[model samples]
Target: MIKPFSVIATRLVERTIRINQAARTFYACEKGSIFINFGVIVVPLIAVVGLGVDVGRGYVVKARLSQALDASALAAAPYADNVVKLQAEFTKYFDANFPSSFMGVDITLAPPVISDNGTKVTVSASAILDTTLMSVLGEDTMSVSASSEVTRLITPLDVVVSIDTTGSMGSSDGSGTRLSSAKDAADILVNKLFGNETESDNLQVGLVPWSAAVNVAERGVSYDSGLNTFVDGHWYTNNSPVPFITEPDSDWQGCAYARYTDNSNDDDADHLLYDADVGGTIWEAWEPMPRRVVNPSNGNLYTVRCPEWGISKLSGTKSHATDAIEELSNPTGTTTIAQGLVWAWRTLMPGEPYNQASIKSNLRRAIVIMTDGLNTSSYRDAYKGDLNVSEMNDRLSAVAAQIKATGVDIYVVEYHVETNLMKSVASATTAPYYFKADSAAELEKAFEKIGTELSELRLSK
Candidate 1:
């Protein structure tokens, strides 16, 4: 009855249950071991990630410090006349931004480093920044250095502002129209060159208004005695045989000359004569006035005395230049860069006779040339016909090169020039400062940039 088969079956079932329990215990032990092993690897990875975050923050601080330092260095350099002041400004700028970094900074300034006849200065600033993360990798500090050279800009600035008063200037670019925008920029530049207050006698500016030919401003008339007599509200010469300006009650109440250039084809050139006299006195008739010697090369000269009158002073009085601009209502002339460059040279060099060596040497010589179009005219060729714009550009490049060689800094501003030709002219400068203003907004910014660069920094004064 208690069969042997039944007992054997029961024994087999007990053995199977014991084997399954042993396997489960072994599996649990292995799983715990694997978890511990994996945690060891993950701990170091998290620490490294945390370190990277701190490193990025440090980099941002360093970048900001670099920018602030550059600006401070330029400002401080002018004040740093000697090594002592140089060190002081360096410390001031450095400490203001990176207080801890520049604590023990090493500054080295070489002699003759001071500019503006030693009233302003220049020096190299260097510092070591301690690394927070890299230190653990055996590198502790990173060395950084910045060099600065600053000279007082307060010296004489022979600024020849070549403005495009062509027909296009009347079009809206930005800050009103091109002409208005240019005047705005010009006013700022003038203030900077000749300090806003009492501009020194050393600084002189020649404003060249160019459409087809450069119009010599009233300011520059004295240099060319011929041009002065022609523009000073006179028909023929001031001392003409007919006597335009006689004693008191002369029959001719001093005729106002024709405002339009005689060569213009407009019928109004003959019909309407602008009253040149301040009191509106009209000249009797328009005779074929002799050509005043505009070009000495052409063998013509004006014998009359050109009056010395300023259109505007430091006090901002009535501006004849402004009036001249207003008079140009229908400005339809094309641009000729060659003539503009030539005029700029004339203002600076004044040729052999009027070249003042003292002014050239002591003062800062500079030319700010800006144009929206490529050269379309040449002195050798007439501008009216279908001009080979490229050929005229070549002539312009040559003229620019000639002027740059005379030791004056040329700042070339291209409003919308193509790549190839713009750089060619810009490259001729000793210190090439080039800009491309494509839009009206950009043009305004371009002018602001020029004004900022042209500012003066007086040291001794």
Candidate 2:
């Protein structure tokens, strides 16, 4: 067994060589496995990072799409009546808001949906974003969508249109008579407010066709304990005798003079020209007296020939307003803006000679006064027929302030007349409350714009 040492040593060397070769082979295999594992991890890591980036891009695209959709819906809301026009408006606004190929995204807009009897508008859109590194997972693109809706509802509104039927309106404004033009403009406004309904529970309109005086018609008269007479819900006494009157109180016509304490003394007078209350102050019947001019044809010197068209109280019936407007003919008398405006204010109030209005806090009241001339008459000169321009303007301003304080918006439309008085009365410093029209066409456009604004469009979604 202990034979030759050389043979044993050779065998041991051979064994050692084999062991070293095996170790080398194992090392090479371990290095190859590490490379394979690194390669396998790199693809999934890249996919995860790309997923975050692409998802973030999709979110951005979705936000932009939602905003554009909202804007488009609102823009198209007003044109809900016509499908073609509504779609045109929606596309116009959406394109303006969101550009094509924005954020490397492909956008597709769906057609607008109009419902609820043309009161609701709905818009939707979809976007696709191409994937960059996520293509390894077979997802070449990401999808996002957005939608928006808008609804327009009309609010409760009460409007009184005070048209100037003075003699100056009988003249021409390069088209037709100013009075005719006013009628046409007023008709347009009424049509807009009424829309398809002949009568509405939330809408009421009144007409006050005024000139030098208003024809209040015949109203009941009662006597108080102090011999004071309550005529047409206004208190009056013998002390303030009907101005320059020779006829008895029973024969009194429909016209009434402005309220004042005394008709004789202008210095010691307390003017109630702007008061709308029924029980407090004294009033006087409007009697032209001996100043009446005789008609050459009839040989009759009518004592009181006020405006033929009288005041029409607030009513929801469209025909009532249109009928009153149609009767706006044969305009004759000087301009008395204060009288027209005060009467309009009274019509809007809940308690007055005209009690057609309700006392709701949410009601929106407005006065549209269209005039073609300046103030030529005043309460102080109602009997004398004197031209008190300054006093008339002051009274108009005071009445306008009082009306505005009661949350009633006053819109002044001066047709064929240029004056700062109307602008000031309308408080035009902040809004487009005052409009000046030199022609009949311009006047119609102005009234149309006002009517559209008064219609009150809003987003309800």
Candidate 3:
């Protein structure tokens, strides 16, 4: 007979095994549900990451667009704010600024629009950045745009046009003869300034034609009463006057001699220019030039002439400027570029000795020196070419700095010739205003361009 307790124990063991199997099945089903939920979450996560990458690219493109637009607007602000004229410049600068290639990017530029009576210029541009990862969101590209504006202002300006009329200018080239071409260019510049039908009370122009010497045309001057005059390699003073030329008082003829510049102390008032008596460096002792005047009364006697073209003071009238340019003549003498520069500066000074230019308010004062050769002149009274070629360049560089220090800018135009020394002279004031011309037309173009630059072209915005 089987015991009842044994059968009950067997039944208990079987029930425990079945309960454990059911628990494992429930766990397996719960694990499958968790994996399915993860699959759904992964889709949005990928989209979020793609959105971030594509949006970042879009922002970069937009930033670049803004920079290009701003640059274009500033460049075009100088014109009449005419969109047609500005289009080329706008595209050119924008291409230069945004010079890199973007992946799947397309750029479009809208024409500039003028407002505020042709004083304000506005530029609009747009770019489309194609999506890389976020393209799955039914969006192919993101559109971005930039707009910029600038106001054109009229900056008050003054300019001095100085010419080198040395014998070398007699050389002929493809631009016609140098002197003739220079005259044409100067006339063109004057017409561009005062004859453009634009009211120009704010504009004034001066002409200085220089050679071995400069003539101020009968002006009062102050000079150093100390140094003696050197004649034909002989040094003497008025106390022992050597009667070779006319007296300084009677036949002085309102001409200025070069100023003595002591390189050791050129900053001294004695070295200062626009004064006459500072050792008579301007004129070369009134010597006989190669040209002879056969007056019957004088009986073939030699006559003296200053080694320079007469100066025309700063004037606003077109006739005044034209007449001045027409009077430029071929003279036989060596080159004295420093004297030319000094006298040009004199024409722009405020008081004493050629007091033509004055500044009560802000103005753009500039000097344009056009030369075809190297500087071959020096402070004859004191230095007298003691400074070699290299040394002379140093002296000119110092003088140019002095002029620039007094709020004047210097521009150099090298025609039919180019040299490192001339470039240095121009760069002493500001960069890239130095122009080189190999032909006659090119020379004229250079002057016209400089004239345009000296005019008022202010970016107001």
Candidate 4:
């Protein structure tokens, strides 16, 4: 019994010592773990938050770069002609729009050359931005670029200044009488075409005075009815033959071919034909042609008659048809739009004496056919019985088609076309044609908008 009790007591003491050692080890381990947890978790959380702040700053800078690039592109478009000016403008724009705080922003423009020759304008620009947070990820900076090539807006413009010269033109619109306002608009266009006396050479202007009938400039000719005998009324000469105005036929004996002629040796043959009709009492056949020279003294009018053919034709002179515009005050007769359209086509035709150069080739060719009233039957007595609106529309549409086929753009404007019969007629033509204005102000705004769209500078050398 004594041996057993001694053994028991010794075991109890060993257990107590072992328990105390374990308690001390637990306390030491808890202290060490607290330090390690603070370093590994809390420190990394702070570093991650710092990186997020830097990343956010980088994004903000990148967004600014994008906006600045767009603003700079727009500022550069207008100055595309002057490279130095474009660069200067870009710098100004970039500075104003993209002021960077983190790092300096740089912009570059390529091919700063602008040609005056009719061509397209194109511009390329790039921007570089520096980042703070991303740099910590081994990325020090970021770059962005943008490019925009705006083909200078070329508006197809055709305007028939059908001034309401009727005595009412004496009334005022904005500044003065309707006539005065019309003149102001015309002068604006004139100034635009010719900056000074020298630049005027590149542009052509023709006047149409309409009262009973729209009479064109002395140089203007109408290609509507009588000429339709040639090519079934299609004025674009390439079509099949219908009629030639200066033919020895009985219809044109009283008139002469006043169109322009090159100094071709063969023009003398054309003169022979004209002379036979004017001077000769009989018709003659076409033969091998000889070239003729234009009389410089006659403002470049070619009047050489058939010397060999013994035909004494009258000299070529400007048309006697006065401008019908002066009589706008006495708009007594009915409106025949066919006549107006024909005249418009002639005014834009090339190779014609009145049309000095091709308005189509050099400048944009556009026609604005506007009318308050519908087709009439009074003036053209020949078609009195055949009062077909459909027929009239077909004629107008045919002419429009021919003109458009030749690359001339057309726009038809109507004051009250919705309830009118001619609305469908204008609608069937090539491009956009419509009208829905209730007030005069709307009308004027529409006109101005059309003008702006059509007058956009078409870049050409």
Candidate 5:
């Protein structure tokens, strides 16, 4: 214990060196542990950030794919019956919505799936997105997929087709008489609407062959005093006899003039003429005048003839409508578009003379008025042929407004001529509701389009 000073000093120095070596070894161990911990934490953190970015990109691609799939499904749903057409439509809409190099991702679209006897359509697509950050985790790419479904459901629908049977329709429209072309076009529409079935539970169609006046009598459309209603007579004048005609009420044909109380008051006159209320004004029976009226256009004397074919009330049987349309021959009368439109509107009403329409709240009513000329005649009363062209057209427009207000879509198909009134009436329903067909083929195509639209294509999923 009692060693020399040099020995004590050497021991102290050795002890100090040993303590410094221990401290250095401890510091090196801590530094090595920190470096190992940083390596472990940073690698995972980078991977997690990359996963987030890649997953976010995957979600974006999936959203876009969903949108494109939906569009494709809806576009192809209408053509479910034809495999060729459905495929064509699906590819067209998908290409329009999603490009080949969308978001730098590779895309593949599957064929459209049609089921439920062609009533349902399903569209699916997928995208292969190359992963940037996720590659470190052994995921080189991510697959995102989406699908959409559409269903073709036929809703309760009532359609009234009012065709002009004016004399001008007898003229040739290149291939055949305008009347013949119109008949062919109408047949196409009915065929499309009915499809393979002769009758449908949810579909009802009515035909209104109109000229200077409607022939309601031929259909036995008359007012019923016992029921206090006009049975089968849509909006017919209530308990009114023929005016200005010396013939007895029994001799009155089923033809009726437009109702009017006071022509001097424009508002009141229009209200009386266009309003469907049965109690407002009385409709007078049209009787052939003893003297023929002078034809202004040809300076020849001609008697007015009611359209031979009467209004065909809404019926589920396709043959009933076709039969009425087939009888649309001998076009020989002045144009009275207002009368035709009003009669068609009455056919769609649930409570009127033709109460064939359903009282359901979801019923869809539409009026397709196909005319070849302008209004050349007025109501069959005092101003029968006295009103000028402007007055007649104004009346037609007023009636159109009233019809559209009742939530009935009005489609105007102008054949061979276009008019401002036709455009305005069609626009009242919506765009593309107005179709101008210059030829027979165009007319057929227009009706086909309308029938397809009315079939009611919707997305079920």
Candidate 6:
């Protein structure tokens, strides 16, 4: 009994000592637990925030750099005549748009790569951004890069000017007549085109002066009519075969009247081949009756021919065009703008009689049609049936549509006229192409603007 009691007491004492040691271990283990929690959780949280800030800063750098690079590429495209010039332009533009350094940030730009055709340019810019919080992670800075590409705007321009030269063009405004003002403006336009370069393979110009009628059938220009017989100078009159002419030509003039659809369907929307034709001896052909000699006793008419309409064929030289204008005689007869438009369209078309220079692929053709008066269908008019002003406008509109359909840009300028009718004429084409000149000086300015507008810049990429 005594031995069992002593053993129990010793075991109880050991149990108490073991319980005290466990309590002391619990207090010691929890002593610095708050600091451990802070080190483990708060440190990583701060690092993550710092990384986020640094990464956000990298995005900012890239966005700004990208904007600058894009601007630089675009500004440099036009001046990219050579690598040195393009690089200089890019640097100038980039420096102006974005900072080379921001708060110790350094930027580097690569020499832009210009495509073989010089139409496209690609550039890349990079920047090194110093970090704030991320430095704690042994990363002192971050890198960002931006790239951009740009394309040039204009294609080569082949332009034609079909101007009215009726007696009405000689009618005066406050200063000069319409014809005179047009001549001055055209001369200035030519100067702008050729500049100092006497020779350019890219630009070609044609001039058509129309009055009373155009000299297509009578003048016998090569046309799609499949009628090459005009070279023989034997032409029908008033729908009669040449043999039907009993009297000699009293006044045989080479003036193209409207063809079947051209005259009957004056507002021809299809703008088929008929609209381009000047017609033949068939009722479709619109030519003035052959001149007849008055037997004096019988008062018979004779076929006395007048000179054909004058056209300056397509040429690349300013001198050629200006000289042709100089050769033009004083205006006479009625206004037939449609004929002038058709002939001008023909001048730009590739193939025989014209385009001795050969039609280059991808040629950009354009037309500038100027008229001082409205179209008519009197004896002065070329159509078989008389057409009122509205009908005349419809015909003009149809012809304009046809020309544009051929991928030829058309610009219409009405001189001293402010009618929507004229504005409608201008509206048939792209915007900024329609011009209403109230004065001679304004006319000149319009021509200048046309020249500038034709040589414009557009964003390609």
TM-score of every model? 0.47, 0.67, 0.61, 0.43, 0.69, 0.54
lDDT score of residue 150 within candidate 4: 40
Q: Relative to the true structure, how large is the alpha-carbon lDDT of every model? A: 0.47, 0.69, 0.61, 0.40, 0.71, 0.62
* By TM-score: ranked, best first: 5, 2, 3, 6, 1, 4
Worst 10 residues of 6 by lDDT: 239-248
Model 2 residue 116 CA deviation in Å: 4.1
Judge candidate 3 against the unseen true structure and give its global Cα lDDT, from 0 to 1. Answer: 0.61
Give the per-residue lDDT digits (tens) of candidate 4, residues 297-359.
Answer: 454533222111111111111111112222233233344455455445555555432334344
| Least accurate 10 contiguous residues by lDDT in model 3 | 283-292
Q: Which candidate ranks first by TM-score, i.e. highest?
A: 5
Clashing pairs in 2: none
Query: Better model by lDDT, 3 or 4?
Result: 3
Residue 377 error, candidate 2, Å: 4.3
lDDT of 3 by residue, 143-257 (tens): 7777887764455556678888877887775545688888888877776455233335566678777765665552113222254465665433333222223334433322344
lDDT for each residue of candidate 2 in 19-100, tens digit (9 for 90 to 100): 4565465556655476665565566556666655666666678888898988888767655655786789899999899998
Sorted by lDDT (best first), the order is: 5, 2, 6, 3, 1, 4
lDDT measured at residue 206 in model 2 versus the true structure, 0 to 100 = 91
Which prediction has more favorable TM-score, 2 or 3? 2
Query: Where is model 3 more than 4 Å wrong at Cα?
Result: 1-47, 70-85, 99-101, 113-121, 150-155, 180-197, 200-204, 214-312, 315-334, 353-355, 375-402, 419-430, 433-461
> Cα deviation of 441 in candidate 3 (Å)?
7.0
Name the better of 2 and 4 by lDDT.
2
- How many clashing pairs does model 6 include? 24
